[model samples]
Target: MRSWLLKSLYVLAALRYPRIRPDLRYFVRDNYFARLNQLRFWRADFLTKTPYKVVEFYGEFDQEIRYAMPFAYWHFLNGTLKQTVASKNTRPFYFFSPDHVEKYEKRVWEAGYGNYSIPNMTHAPTYDFSKWARVPFKSHYQNDVFVYDKPLLVIANKYNIEWDKPPINFLDIPALDRLISGLKSRYQIVYNRPLGGQIVHDNSEIMDLGEHAWLRTTHPEVLLMNDLFDQHAATVQNFNHLQLLVYANCNHFISMHGGTAALASCFGGTNILLSHPGGGFEHEFNEYNNLFPNLSGATILHAKSREEVFTLVEGRF
Candidate 1:
């Protein structure tokens, strides 16, 4: 009868539309709530150093101060948009205070490079000087501030962040061993991690990764990577800043910037780009609109993917 028909429809609907899983619901809710905690922690950290209302309108202070270009660039430029764009492998031009610019140029000479490249494209912040200028170490020259002494090199283990891929720890002993084996020169490298706290001492100086103790190697001292996320659990928002800080402290930084040659320019340090032929830079996430200076003195030769990383070092040294 009518009741039976209604029941049949109801059963069919129930069968077709299953209830959301409790675990998934919890995961979503947990992340939502966790984000709030994360925001509170980030705000507290900034407030401790700066005024409370500095980031009041942004809700989360960290996100407002540290931005991802394209979407955030407008906000960063205070709603001013620039028309500059990269055309088929052009280098980016950047301007610092005259004093900082002199120091910046000198570092480039010491690093023995002209232009640095980082991956980039349409949506990225068209300019990210603020993000580039702030070094984690107290010593980095900001704007007009300049430090010319021998600096420490800070490297972030961002290579393992491929979406849908496994999270590989650079501090993992076996992996470091393999990575070291591929290297010829002894470049001092400190691997930075996200610990969700203030970055303290370098972890590579202490961690005992047997056989992977490439740190023992005098020339290329390899440091262990620490999880900055775990340490700063509330404040550190992204790993890119960690890399920027490292670059600020170190004599020079070598990175693929997730394979974006354009990001290297805005980052304000020496960079080596790994170019992939015919890949058309298609895989790169260029939302940051990082400007690449087209000047020859500003850029180095691009390395095709066919070239091994070790080989590049051999020639550089």
Candidate 2:
């Protein structure tokens, strides 16, 4: 019935916006079908019974890096604990979408959960457990780390888009160049780009930001310094796991305020979050504190300007 209703809404939207029907179709698929699958699995947890504890994560499939990785890992830690404390005969079973199941199967299994699965309408109920879980930061699954040989500094920047209000939480090309130049002598710097199409706005018009926008739309020369500096377009090349691995091993991380920053937080290193005070999202810092309250060898700083960022990075290194 719900699927029928959503399909009806999609049809209505298609008829109403005939000119951009293709975009509307994608919008419906992402917003409706994806979210509906999450809801179905979440609801199934309540009706099913298992010998072991069950934890359900349902929502926000679109931003896998920001929402899925950190949130799912948190639950995976909790599910492992619940199973261990309950009984050796029973083990926790985690339910996630098949896409996630395929991508993160090894990591989920290593976190100590008994089983992870994709659910359907007829699936039995599993326990609905709630309570945020925290675990030590370590490279649990992928043991092979990318050794930079030299001191490594990972930089994540946002361009051609505005994610925050007022001052805007982005570094201009010149500012970024200065930051990179200042550290080039001391560390090997690598730029990490977000994995997905960015939004480009021209006056009142908006459209998808092309994949090569970073290389073509911007001054490519600014990024292509010498062998000392490198750029990794993770999203354009679909290098999600590789990006995570690099973040896991980097000596330091500097990122704009966004999902990538959140994922970096999980790695537990010297992290500097460049944020705009006008954005009014200061609570994110406190939330991260709670999530990673016991992280050792980790220092997190919030910087708003080039000088502050440089100073923070210098102080850390």
**Which numbered prediction scores highest in lDDT against the true structure?**
2
lDDT of all predictions: 0.32, 0.44
Question: Candidate 2 on 1-317: residue-level lDDT in tens?
Answer: 85686677578556655654363343433333433444644533344422233333322121223223333444454333121121111111112212122222111212221122311111111111132222333454224445555766777765534432233555665666667667766776666654322221122112233323453344343222112223334322224434544666675878776544555665666788776654523332243343322333456787766678878877776
Q: What TM-score do all the candidates reach, one by one?
A: 0.36, 0.51
Clash pairs (backbone) in predicted model 2: 47-125, 48-124, 48-125, 195-235
- The global Cα lDDT (0 to 1) of model 2 is 0.44
- Expressed as tens digits, the lDDT of each residue in 151-268 for candidate 1 is 4333333333323334322334443444455442445555543332332211112223343234455324455444333454364333444444444444443334332333333344
Q: For model 2, what is the error of residue 177's alpha carbon versus the real structure, in angstroms, after optimal superposition?
A: 1.8
Error of 1 at 35 (Å): 33
Off by over 4 Å in 2: 1-71, 74-130, 135-137, 141-145, 163-167, 195-237, 283-297
